[model samples]
Target: MKKSNEASCHNRVSQQGIKVQLEIIKTEARGWGVRSLNSIPSGSFICAYAGELLEEKEAERRTSNDEYLFDIGNKYSDGSLWGGLSNVMPDAPSSSCGVVEDGGFTIDAVEYGNVGRFVNHSCSPNLYAQNVLYDHEDKRMPHIMLFAAENIPPLQELTYHYNYVIDQVYDSSSNIKKKSCFCGSSECTGRLY
Candidate 1:
C-alpha cells in the first residue's frame, strides 16, 4: 500500500483502474451533495470522513443539538452499531480513550471537514460508510471511508442512508425539526431522520 497520506487522496486513480475523484455540487433538493467525477466500481474507496475528532462526552455534549456529528462508538466492539441519527440511544456506552487507545469517539465536521461531509442521504444510496483501519490499528477510531456500494457512473451523486432511527419519539410533534428527504428515489422514506 502507498503511504497513508497518498492513499487518502481525494482525486486519484487506483491500481484497480477505478478513478477515485469526487466533487461537491449544489443539489436540486439536498442543498449540496458529493458527485463522482469518474466511474467508480463497487467496493472502491471514495473518501474518508475527515474532521475534528472529539472525546465521546465532548462529542455528545457538542452534538446534543447539532447535526454534523458522526458517532463512531460502536467501532470499538463487534456487536451492532450505534450513533449518528441512526441507532444511537440515551443509554449507549461511552469511552475516554483516544483514537490510539481503541476507544470510541465522534467526528465533528461542522467547521472542519472534507468533501465526504457533502454526501447526501438517499433511501436507495449507492455509497456506504465503511470503517477502515489504515495507518492505525485502532478500530474505535477507524477512518470512516465512503465506498461505492454499487457501480457508480461519472457525475452521479453519491449518497447513503443516514440510518436515522424512527421511533415513538420521532413521531412526536416535539421533534418537528426533523428534515425531509428529497432524494427522489422510489424508496424515499420522505424524512431524513
Candidate 2:
C-alpha cells in the first residue's frame, strides 16, 4: 500500500460533479496524445495514478522479461526512474506524487489516479510533469508534485517528453540515442521505435 496527496487544479462544473476531458491522439512514433480535457489554465493537475507501491526490484521482478516497455531509469538509494517517472510513493494514499523510505504515512483511497500512464513519449511534447515540493503537517516527510507543462486547449491530447533532454544531448553512445518521434504534431521528427 502507498499514499499520495492532492495536486492538480480542478474546476467545479456542478455541485456534485467535476469534469476534465483530455483528448487522445495517435502519431507515427508516439502513439497517443493527451490534451486539455477542457481549457486548462497554467498550473493545473489533469489527473494522477494510484496503485500498489513497488520497490524497483519488485517492479522489475513483476515485469516479465518481454515487457521491455515497463523499464524506468536508475534507482537511487531510495528510488528509481522509468516508464517516464521516478518511483513515487506518497505519504497518504491520496497524496500527490512523492517518494518514501521504509516507514512513511499511508492513505486509504486513491483520488485522481494513473491518468498519465497512457500518455506516450515525445521528443517534442505539449505536456510535461513538474516536480513540486509539498509541505505537510509533518515536516519530516517530503512530498513531490506533478503538473502540466504548458497551457492546453480543449480537444488536444496531452503529452510529455519521455527521455531526459540533457541525457539525450550529452549521451555519446548510440545506445542512448533517442528513438525518432512520430507524434504528427507539426514538430514531429518522424523516426521512433
Candidate 3:
C-alpha cells in the first residue's frame, strides 16, 4: 500500500509529499492551476506548501498584498486565529488585515514555492489546507498541509477553499475588498477573497 501510494505521488516533484505526481497546467481564465496525475483517496496527505519561512517584520516589509503569503498563526482553543489576550481581541494584526492573523509567522511563497502555490480556490473543492505540527510541539506555528478532502479521481483539477473571512476584509479607503471568482462551481460564491 505504501509503495503504491508513493508511486501515485511521484518522486520527481519533491522529496516531500511524494505520494502523488502533480502537474501544473494553464487554466483558460485562472492563469496557472494544478491537476492530480492520479487518484488520491480521501484523507490522503498531498503535500506541504513549501516556501521560505518568514518572521512578522520581514513579512511586513516584503508585501502584504502578495497572493503567495499564507498565515500559520496561533489558533484559539477552538482552532481559530485568536490569541485571546483579551476577550474578542485579535492575537496580532493580520498582515493582510483580512481575517487571517499572522500569529508571528507567515509563509511567503511568491518567489520560492512548490506546486502548492498553483492550487486554486474553489467553493466546492476536493482538497483542503490544514495546519499540522510535525517538527515541533508548538501548536502556535505549524506546517500548512494539503489533504484530499474527498476521493479525488485521476486528471481532475485540485482545489481547496481559501477560507478567507469576509467580514474582516475592510480597508479605510474601500469599505470592502473583493476579487471575482471564476471557479464556475454551482456553489461558487462569486468572490475569491
Leading candidate by TM-score: 3
Provide the overall lDDT of each model, using Cα atoms, as 2-decimal numbers: 0.67, 0.42, 0.70
TM-score of each: 0.70, 0.46, 0.73
**Is 1 or 2 the stronger prediction by lDDT?**
1
Error of 1 at 146 (Å): 0.7
- Give the poorly placed runs of model 1, Cα more than 4 Å off: 1-19, 75-103, 168-177
Give the alpha carbon lDDT tens digit for every residue of 1-193 in model 2.
6443334223221121224675556654544445654886544555542334444444434433211222222222322222223322234233243343343321111222354555666666655443322334432222222345556677766666644343342122334444455566676556443
Candidate 3 similarity to native, TM-score:
0.73
**113-184 in candidate 3: lDDT tens per residue?**
888989988888887776665568665566777777778999899987777776555444545766788999
In model 2, the worst 10-residue window by lDDT is: 9-18
- The model with the greater lDDT, 2 or 3, is 3
Ordered by TM-score, highest first, the candidates read 3, 1, 2
Better of 2 and 3 by TM-score: 3
lDDT of 1: 0.67
lDDT of model 3, residue 32: 89
Report the C-alpha lDDT of model 1 over 34-152, residue by residue, as the tens digit: 88889878767677777899877677567444557777665444333423213212454544323344447889999998888888888888877756564677666767777677888
Candidate 3: residue 56 Cα off by (Å): 3.3
